[model samples]
Target: MSIPTLRMTEDLLVAILLGDSTIQKKSAKHELKFYLPPNKQKILKMYIEKYKLQSLICIEGVNVETDFFIVSNSLVLERIIREWSDGTSVIFLDPRLLKNSTYMLWLCLFGRKVNNQVIIKQNTLTLDTKHTLIYFFEKTMRTSFLRLNAEGHLKVQAIDELLLASIIDNRPSYESLALHELLTDHSKKSFLQKQEKMKEEMREYACF
Candidate 1:
């Protein structure tokens, strides 16, 4: 089996780390281009976390351009504009995480501190994030759905939808070996069974 990979600029890498990356929602590549921000880790800790990434790898600079290999387990954060343009960024979040009102509140407060436009593509249909928590939380449903589908969530339409759509829309992005690996996986659970499971999980998330 093999995995997909990614090769992006360092600035783009930071945007991903911060989860402030963004892209056109219509694009199949939207899964790789969601929004999340980093607020706690120091630079050293962040480096350590990434360096030790089980699903990520940061190789040394060489004479030639570097490429990153990602698989179903990972995603490369999206970049809509130059990282230096401003503080703008985006990342997809886990809907279940929204139960933690503290995180949502912080995002709202941060939006105010920035005092700039904040938009969520799924909600505002624009490239921004300075919006209310409820809006962003709602936006997570759509954005996170694509991401979960890509990551092999059982309820997500596997071969027929997001994964297959990506195969067509993102053929060149995935290497031949990685694509073969993705094409070969077989899940035994029926769609109804998966739905039942997803519903149970949703119940837990809804409690918050």
Candidate 2:
């Protein structure tokens, strides 16, 4: 199947990828919902339906896990499943991480790739789809810590870019990282620093 023209604009796409939104914490219920700008949310709703991804969630709870190709678009699924029938799968991560920008920042600090398991990040999770560190960061942010304001608008657009840029600096390499990083490299220092911190956190997560 030929790839359809992705109608999502670059700016909106970035917001969606980053999960940009204002957050609200409800102590009583302990619930969260990431919101996009009104226009953007409408756009996303349409895309989700068009892509038939409304029910595509694979991983459950805080950590998500699922077959890669199942959630991918026809174009990507066809390409990835060709070589490996089983292909690779990814973890969606916990929603809480969205609120934990520090942790989110740390995860994207490195371009991580280990054998067949290509772990990067994106706003929406797709099977067999290699995720960019920035994309991954945005996913965690929206799923975990972000939401739309009462008026149904985004609160921090500029801040999102700054945060995204800072997170990019945290990632060292993208070539061996995710397919998305095949050619983009602007933030080497921050990426390296964030990488070290992540290693420590990984040890902690593993300890429990």
Candidate 3:
């Protein structure tokens, strides 16, 4: 799969990072264009919504140029960093420079600082650590689900393993061969099933 080429200005990113710019709740209508691998998409959405990311955008993919504030976190932090690793020009904000809303998210999403530095996984430099956690967590969750389903103890219906694998493996960023090597059919199905059930439970118990 081909790496996505992001076309944007560095100065704007710097402005946002430096707290020199302001973001409104709504900006001019812009189409957000991002094509992540399939498996990564759900993970990305989870991070975005969990972080209330739209609060940080001055303009989001509307005109030829748009500004955004990205709140990097566990599942999608590595992906965001990977996008910036190719000299794509990412601006990192000093923790103090962030707005109240941004600061709240950083604290809630990333946790408190240890010593003076906060341990965050943003780019490829930290991808190994972040991906390792994601991989192991997903793998463990998948195993738990498969064990339950196999024992005829499913909370709902189950789908074919191959189909689930296809959903997780067919994203544009990761090559099919790579995905195939990374995730077995059974593992992918179990992972997807667990993810689906988790979402259903969250919605069922969501407040307001």
Candidate 4:
């Protein structure tokens, strides 16, 4: 299956990946969402230019992060799955690290979060078959999976990005040390360890 032409344009410049938006607090009844840091905003643009992925979207919380929504033709998501099966930008890493998950930022974000969860508009790409972003993430896709016991209350289900999100940084070898140090999450020792392992594997090009 051929992927439709993916053109990197301002229109495709969807959202920014700010990092673990995990809600650690439950003050009362409301579930607050995380916002992207302004400092990271510039860096996010840089990351997009650096990686040549203009279509990346911030998929953490319903309408785009700033509550800015663009009504346009988004990618037909199933095209990504088709391309992956046809071996496009699909990166293979240790199975333990990533099980059927493709690390494409768009797929990761789009499948999961919208922006503010405000339901500004129910926008969906025309997949080969109709599929909501959430449905594809939990069921059709492997990179993101729903928890085992959340079947009863599907709305509150927690999906896990099985692989360490750090692996998405596919910079060249010389930058490994820098990326390793910079991408560390001091809160999670395991996350840092995964980065260490990734840095090592990338050194020998074992995981590159």
Candidate 5:
């Protein structure tokens, strides 16, 4: 069976690593393991299928009654482990990996909506990684970032949530569609306002 392109797989892997996944070495092969609640199993499976990944094995957690794990092994995964892992438990992500907005949208699956805003809790991320990711979001997505909370969780605040919704609408993947469901009604209102303003500007330009 053929696997997805390297770039696509790498983006998915990076998004997974940002969530509840880890990389471990067994003998000479590197394995990507994802630990999530049973409720999240469907999303995890959908993500794997969406990426057309191969050799991924899902296993029920032996100790945790409410959780399970998925294990995936591939040479591409090994390359990711070597490039992203710091030879320790901490994973150092390069900001360049944020190029794929679709995968970035998938990262929202790990986030929760609060007060009409989506907040991604990055408590486990290192300081450098957190800052870099914040920079990437602000520079590319027109979003805002809040200072780290008491728990060391960096909160990403979308000043205009519709910007994210627009990205999700364009992708039309399972992950994107799921994230779209989490968007607040305020985003729809904002999107409509932006559309009207754009139309007005276009009409004015045409008049000239």
Candidate 6:
């Protein structure tokens, strides 16, 4: 079988690198590996089909193990690493390359909704990478919606969820859409009200 040409993109490369995917090199060849639980096989399949990477993909331990992995015989990931990563495996992605919102949407996959906010766990990222992401988000959304939580993860509160959903090209998952709607309808107003109330309380405290 002939090797397929991978339809690689900067956004997709960054997205995968932000996820559970890793790059490995052997005998002058570089490959990308994605490890997922059995339940997440559909994600791997979707990526393979989306990128026209079917011929280059190899699946391992799908049926016999609780976890499985997919390997893509491509050098694209290595090229990205060379450009983006420091020698210590910490990525310092160039802010100029983050022009597409699709990657931000992809990053949301690693997030979980909490009390009308989406908290994206990015503990693995270097501080530089985190700052770059924050800069990119603010520049693209034209708002200061993204911030780092106390745990150093990326967070977007309810007030900005609608803006985020609107900017991304791909449709969000049903759960995310539902949450966005609920937050947009209720949380935005209440969040503002709370902020005002807090200011009033501080004024009262100052007077006392």
| lDDT, candidate 4, 93-159, per-residue tens | 1222121222233323322222311111112222321123344445534443332122211121212
lDDT (CA) per prediction: 0.30, 0.31, 0.31, 0.31, 0.57, 0.54
In model 4, pairs of residues that clash are: 15-57, 15-58, 61-115, 62-115, 62-116, 62-117, 101-143
Count clashes in each candidate, considering only residues at least 3 apart in sequence or on different chains.
23, 22, 2, 7, 0, 0
Q: What is the TM-score of each candidate against the true structure?
A: 0.22, 0.20, 0.20, 0.30, 0.68, 0.58
Q: How much is the lDDT of residue 25 in candidate 3?
A: 19
lDDT of 2 by residue, 1-208 (tens): 2123222122122222333211122332111123332322333445445545544322112222321111222332233223222222222332322333333322232212233222223323333222332344455445322223343322221222333444455632221232233112433344445557778888999999
Q: After superposition, how far is residue 33 of candidate 4 from its true place, in Å?
A: 18
Best by lDDT: 5
Instruction: Name the lDDT value of residue 101 in candidate 3.
Output: 31
Whole-model lDDT, candidate 4? 0.31
Give one digit per residue, the lDDT tens place, for model 3 in 10-102. Answer: 222322222222222113221122222334334334544543443433333333233232322222233433343332323332322222233
Residue 202 shift from truth in candidate 5, angstroms: 9.5
lDDT minimum window of 10 residues, candidate 3 = 1-10
Q: Is candidate 3 or candidate 5 better by TM-score?
A: 5
Could you tell me how far off, in angstroms, the CA of residue 54 lies in candidate 5 after the best superposition?
A: 3.3
Instruction: Please write out the lDDT profile of model 5 over residues 55-96, one tens digit for every residue.
Output: 543333534764635445566656666787764344566666
What are the per-model C-alpha RMSD values against the true structure? 17.6, 18.7, 17.6, 13.5, 4.4, 10.0
Error of 4 at 42 (Å): 2.0
Question: Pairing residues by index, what is the TM-score of model 3?
Answer: 0.20
